[model samples]
Target chain A: MIILNILFAIAWMALNNAYTPVDFVAGLLFGFLVIIVSRRVLTREPLSLQSWFTFSARRNYPLLVWRWAAFIVFGFWSIVKANIVMARIVLSPQLRLQPGIIAIPLDITSEIGITILSNLITLTPGTVALDVSSDRKTLYLHAMDARDPDALRRETKQEFERRVMELLP
Target chain B: MSLLEIVTLALTALGVLFIFLSSVGLIRLPDVYTRVHASGKSATLGVVGVLLGVAVYYVDLRVALEMLALIVFFFITAPVAAHMLDRAAYLTGVKPVAGTAPDDLEGAYNRETRSLR
Candidate 1:
């Protein structure tokens, strides 16, 4: 499937007589259409989208694209917010902190889902995703401050994991 | 000079500031784990900010897309690298800073047997 897409992208570039990045992107866009049409004619089963386009169980590309954008923006904003807090901690003279590890239960099951969630958690300031349990049911995270564990967990779930679940599911 | 240029310059400065903050945390933080927390998040976000500035300055679709792709790649990889490092540090039994209560994984692994229970 991937090889076919690559071939279509190459074909698009050749037909257009341009090899620039713009042409590559244009080729990819064209390749999507070519693959969509050819797959239906060649095989009875639908060919799943790959690479930039996510493959979901429902095969809804449009919705996936929208959610993916939202996820990126949210993730970026979360990073900004985390950084501000972390900077405050670093600059403060007192260095008052209650750092500790706590188990954050997992809601996303797939390996990709778990990976994405863990990575985002680590990327967000003040939180580091330590490890996943043997059964993959819980994620252990280290926080810069866990004076209020419930609030920390709540924010993580609401801001990071919730969006990740939406993106992957 | 223009609104877009002003925005680009601001983002670039913010990005540099975050990168600087990461270093500050690295120096002041007590432990290796905490240092990772400082370096990982700020560095990734810092680079992303700089890339955004570049993308904005270019103001072309292809350049913007390429920059976006770079941001995405950095975002995805940085955390994974940090997670691996953190796990390796933990399994090797690097202790946290003093005054931290209740080491949860203390019982989860056997340092003598070198195996996780």
Candidate 2:
């Protein structure tokens, strides 16, 4: 489907005689619209065409790509904020802290999703996903400030876990 | 001197600050588990910021691509590395600092099968 999109984009460019990278990107967008409009026709064809970018048949590729890119950008922003928080903690005079390991029961079963979730947790400042249950139903993580584990759990379940499930499942 | 130069400098400085604080956390934090937070996350972020600054300053496609690749690689690997260190520390009985509690993972590890319960 991507190849088809690029081909369509190239054809559009050729027709318009607009050859800039920006124009190619615009052509790609137009090609995406074309693909969406022609998806049913494409799917009815033989196995060869259907096999191309197989996910496109079952899922909206544009939405998936958008979510993924949004997650990356948002994740980067969170890490920057986390660094500042860690910096404040480290630079502070008092070392008074309450730390503990908490288990977040896992709803995401895919190994890849679990892996990504754990890594995201690790990146978000204070939490490190130490391990998961053998049954793969729970994730064990260490929190730097375990003062409010309930709130933390609530936020994580609502935010990170849901997002991971969306990305993979 | 110029807007681009200023942005590059700011990014580089931010990266350096995070790296420095991570080092401080390494020295100040109580245990290995917590220390991993310092070393793993902030250091990676620092590297990311620095690389991004350089990429922005250079304004070359090749350089930007290389820097982006490095950043993505770091983002993927650093957390896994930290988790490994943490798991190793726990399995070896490197207990977390005092005041740690709710060991949900306790007794989950079996020596014979070497698998979590």
Candidate that would win on TM-score: 2
Taken over the whole model, the C-alpha lDDT of each candidate is 0.79, 0.85
Write the residue-wise lDDT of candidate 1 on A67-158 in tens digits: 78888777778888878888888899988878887787778898999998998888777898877877787788888887887898888888
**Best-fitting candidate, measured by lDDT?**
2
TM-score of chain A of 2: 0.74
Off by over 4 Å in 1: A1-61, B1-8, B57-62, B110-117
Error of 1 at B84 (Å): 2.0
Can you tell me which runs of candidate 2 are displaced by over 4 Å?
Answer: A1-24, A39-58
Measured with C-alpha atoms, the lDDT of residue A111 in candidate 1 is 91
Task: Report the lDDT of model 1 for residue A146.
Answer: 76
lDDT digits (tens) for residues B1-117 of candidate 1: 999999999989989988999999999999877888888888887898899999999989889989989988988888887788877888887988986644566666565654543
Model 2, residue B37: displacement in angstroms? 0.6
Tens-digit per-residue lDDT, B16-100, candidate 2: 9889989999999999988998998889879988999999999887798899999989989999999999999988889889888
Kindly report which residue pairs in candidate 1 clash with one another. Answer: none
